[model samples]
Target: GTYPLYDITASPLTSGTHKFDGPEKNNPYRVLGIDEKQNYARFRFSGERNKRKLNVEFLGIKGEKLGEWSISENDLKTPKQ
Candidate 1:
């Protein structure tokens, strides 16, 4: 029972004179790709600046999420492919 594995990498944010562009809305991103481990999924968020987030879900063979871990922005160190 495994869903898939993947990674979400975002490009660097541009320099500006602001603490934050705006509140990071809990935007739902589409599943971009899967990893070889079959335990994670990648998603991309399109906003003012490019952003990416990874979701690790424990699947139940039929591809269902039983548990998950949301990746933080710091975890991404490179641009997604």
Candidate 2:
């Protein structure tokens, strides 16, 4: 499954509210919303924000990492909504 992209280059993936989005368009992934409070953030391509580095852990619903991806948040160029 797709996961949110966070700038984990600063720190490891942790369970907390954080910002996740595209690093730049044409990347390959995206994170939506900045008003994060849950453990994991939601992201997608669908034209949202700039492309971002997603070399982070993909946290699951239980705050557990499902896997990891080294893609950008610019896979799409439009909102899914």
TM-score of every model versus the real structure: 0.28, 0.22
Query: lDDT per model, in order?
Result: 0.39, 0.45
* Weakest 10 consecutive residues of candidate 2 by summed lDDT: 30-39
* CA error at residue 26 for candidate 1, angstroms: 32
What lDDT tens digits, residue by residue, belong to model 1 across residues 1-81?
333444443222232222212332322453322222234232434334435554554443345653555754545555455
- TM-score, predicted candidate 2 vs. hidden true structure: 0.22
Stretches of model 1 off by over 4 angstroms after superposition: 1-50, 75-81
Runs with alpha carbons beyond 4 Å of true place in candidate 2? 1-53, 71-81
lDDT of 1 at 47: 31
